[model samples]
Target: MTRDHPADFEEIARRFSHLWQALNEGSPGTRKILVDRVRDALDRGEARLRDADCDIVANSFVLEALINDGAATRVYRARHRDLGTFHAIKMPRPDHADDPVLRKLMLREAEIGMGLRHSHIAATQTVLRLSDGRPALVTEWIGSRLAELLQQRPLSLGEITSVMTSVLSGLEAIHAAGFVHCDLSPLNLLADGDLSRLKIADFGIALKRGSRHSQFDLAFAGQPDFASPEQLAGEPLDERSDLYAAGLLLSLLLSRCHEESDGTKTLKALTNHLSQQDVQDRPENARAALHLLGGSPKRPVDA
Candidate 1:
């Protein structure tokens, strides 16, 4: 005899079913009202299911903000809703999304980034697939970039040692894995919130040492300030080339940032030598640079 909002669709269904049964005892008018209510209840149930499915925005990450827009990729600050933690999601720029080349590069970077699981190296959490079928690389979210910070202030000699050691540590692991970070620069080097640790980012152009590559691979994806002489010359790259970049970074780190530069000609010479136009004259590898920093005489690969 009366109609009202039901507790929920399930409750509505249960009540309507009983109403239908009662329809057999009622007039035709009452039976018609019960039929309409049944249709409404079914519609609500279908809508609820669609809403539940809509909750999953992307397969893995839900974007929270656009943290950076680089030349090739746009990085988003996202969260893994399942884990309730923050991460950085790197996706192809909007215009570049449809480009097959960019897609291949993104997959390549994801492959390499996922392989590295070192402390000083930012860890790639997982690969995410967008609704458009594009792949995105998700890494642990970091809040600071070393390049930006250094421009504002300098580091103490002790602080320089800490940063260099950590960077070298990551480089060692990378080189030992047979991969050379073709683009190692202050811009891509990230430090944790407290500036206590460093994490290397951006491997889109990294190449395996001694691996075959493009003729223009040297200038393809590197920052000029940090690009090694061999890298700039289109010569084959190895761990030593990355060492050259590391040496340049090490030089920048030791600039007036330290409270005192009592006696640092040796460090200066090491950095200068690393950027030499001739690759063979640079430190043999990351280990050699570390050794030089530790007061050992520089015996570059002059041999």
Candidate 2:
């Protein structure tokens, strides 16, 4: 019976089964073992998908196909048997679906996404358990990413402000909901119809307001060069971290060239305000940055 099916798929299933065992064991060593096994599984799976003439994500709402394969798991855009629409299906690398850590990450992202309700934030539709016993967080598909837009050309001032407004609005909602978006970067930001509309994506590494911050600095995860000192030092963060990221977004917006000459000055001002390397330095948060941008719409008086 198995011979009728592909040998590669069979091998992948066997490896996945082994990985499941290792993850269920729930030890650091077991996790490491599972990680390697999952990598092999993904490679095989990708080949099978290609052979089947399938895209990374399934086109039909009824079929399940791999959409996003993140560091820890593979997600499929699938139609639920009951719900009858396309939704995100998350599982812990086929092998580690039951792993507590992976399970927690999935739930955490879903909760954060649901809590943050804004046009600029990816909306969480629902979270449910799959028939195969894996967890899924269904969300509105925001389509392609900001990276695609910026690839063509840099955004204009008005365009950037419009996008930032949405992003900041979303951040405000996120902060109000009592969570910190530990990950914020161009890749995580998505564009809808045009550059003016932006949506922040990927909440996997987010931290709740009162939770103890991670020891390893995640600031580097977003963009180390753009990170504020507090993030670089792994200190407890507030709205200031988001401001630092916004400043980078601001720099990208205002700079005439991709690498603006005045970028250093702007970053310096923002870093001083945020990092407080000097005791006398005044702290400027995202709100303050927005205030600065507020005046951008007005033309400077001829002097």
Name the top TM-score candidate.
1
lDDT per model vs. reference: 0.74, 0.62
Q: Candidate 1: list runs displaced more than 4 Å.
A: 1-60, 194-196, 212-219, 256-258, 296-303
Point out the worst 10-residue segment of candidate 1 by lDDT: 294-303
Alpha carbon deviation, residue 127, candidate 2 (Å) = 0.8
> lDDT by residue for model 1 over 1-303, one digit each (tens)?
235545566687997677867788878888778765665566556557783322233644567888888876788888775578888888877667688877887888888888888888988878878666767788898878888878776565666666777788889889988899988888788986444478888888888897534732333567778887667766678998888888788778767464444335666766787777677888788877777767723222110
Lowest summed lDDT over 10 consecutive residues: which window, candidate 2? 53-62
Pairs of residues at least 3 apart in sequence or in different chains that clash in candidate 2: 56-66
User: What is the per-residue lDDT of model 2 for residues 27-52, given as tens digits with 9 covering 90 to 100?
Assistant: 99778767756655675577576644
Going through the candidates in the order shown, the clash numbers are 0, 1
How do all models score by TM-score? 0.75, 0.64
